[model samples]
Target: MTAGIDLGHPQAQAIQSDEDVVRVRQLVRTVAVAARLSLVDQTKLVTAASELARNTLVYGGGGVAEVTTVDNGRRRGIRIVFADDGPGIVDLDLALTDGYTTGGGLGLGLSGARRLVDEFDIVTGSGQGTRITVIKWSR
Candidate 1:
């Protein structure tokens, strides 16, 4: 297995409520801008972060999101991880499907977020809560 590079220390934000989601988006946007990402890329990352943050608040019963600057020798990217301790997803495949939602939403949040970012990873079990990580590389 290829070893993961050491990304710099991450900045964390609490996601206990809707207000925290807004704060996350703002923080993501600021970091995206500071990284000199394109306007479109910045928006994509911010939008994805918003969706995941909301999921943490609504479905996960609140959580914490960690934001970090990543460098893989050749490229720089931003990685955001949303983690919660609430009940976890029951079906990983179904949850990632395009039109699957347990929250009466349009079912576009997770799939759409995956489309927006360059990398995505999720970990969850029936009662283990949920954790999602996404990254967008600078152009």
Candidate 2:
């Protein structure tokens, strides 16, 4: 059957929940391929995805990473968003800076993930929640 819908609608996929880390990795890889990202870019994307997934599980108790592909003319990129409802970050500024750890990472997950990708946005507050989005473009 044919489907009809009005304009001004957005189509998005909310990734599966089971095996969060593995699921995230697969999604990132798919996005990278669809975006025509290079091997280097794919590696970086996967690395960043892993970091965010870990943070969500460890700090957020449990969360899911959403993967989306963005296209702009000759440029294309993949965006990965990690969201959690668990305890939020108390100090965002301190947490972002290198060598800051509440969990047992080199305190580098946030910073390292940022370095691997092109754009990074982290929104977290005490009792509020956390949603981190990172993007890497193919060039």
Candidate 3:
């Protein structure tokens, strides 16, 4: 029902760097494998986790990511929760829209992440913090 993982970086500021993103991606893969996630499911989970991790570093200042495994009889799945206590998004609607971003490059953090996973939830408030959870089911 609930599972968690503690992600660390050399420095909080390093989160914005590509190197940090790579590190988080690696961690996501490892976690997926350890969770016994299927190949198809792994691909999606990893992508979603990567996107959420990048956002936490970029917008949330810095924090950790947690993956939860949920099994409901015939179906099994994993849920990823990215939490950070940084400056929160002021506009949730605008942030979820495609092609919207304050940073450079194609801003597909939310939409792209959503496409990769079965379910996605984001909670944030100004100066409060952010918690993004994405789930992928085994098929």
Candidate 4:
């Protein structure tokens, strides 16, 4: 999260079921459109949101996604925070590796999501759960 930016009140969305993950994509797309993001940017943001939301659901044992619109004076953007209260990641480096997964997934979720968004922040530890924040700025 960037300091000094004005962020609107976040709209919370659940990340429990597979359906909830789909709804998170919709929520992000709506905010991305309102922020004046280009079509490509919007797609990228939505894809990132989907990946992160799934991680929250599968790995984090369900959580919430908070979608918000933000302004940094000149540009507008959408920011999403995915948080969960499950057991946190033990090895951050391995978790971020491109082909490593604790759940037999392809292991591209975190790394791929980082590449798709303009800004990405993740916080997790052994038992601290996980919180991932992604921001997509309008061009």
In model 4, where do residues sit more than 4 Å from their true spots? none
Off by over 4 Å in 3: 1-20
For TM-score, candidate 1 versus 3, the one ahead is 1
Q: Judge candidate 4 against the unseen true structure and give its global Cα lDDT, from 0 to 1.
A: 0.90
lDDT of each: 0.90, 0.77, 0.73, 0.90
Work out candidate 1's RMSD over C-alphas.
1.6
49-117 per-residue lDDT for model 2 (tens digits) = 888888888888886777777754556777777888978999888888999998877999888899999
Per-residue C-alpha lDDT of model 4 across residues 49-105, encoded as one tens digit per residue: 999999999999999999988887878888889999999999998888898888878
Q: How many backbone clashes does candidate 1 have?
A: 0
Colliding pairs, model 2: none
Candidate 3 Cα deviation (angstroms), residue 56: 0.6
lDDT measured at residue 32 in model 2 versus the true structure, 0 to 100:
84
- Residue ranges of candidate 2 with Cα displaced over 4 Å: 1-18
Candidate 2 has what TM-score?
A: 0.84
User: Which model is ahead, 2 or 3, in terms of TM-score?
Assistant: 2
Q: Give candidate 2's error at residue 138 in angstroms.
A: 0.9
Clashing pairs in 3: none
TM-score of each: 0.94, 0.84, 0.80, 0.95
lDDT of 1 by residue, 1-139 (tens): 1123547678899999889999999999988898788999999999999999999999999999998877777777898999999899998889889988999998888999999999999999999999998889888
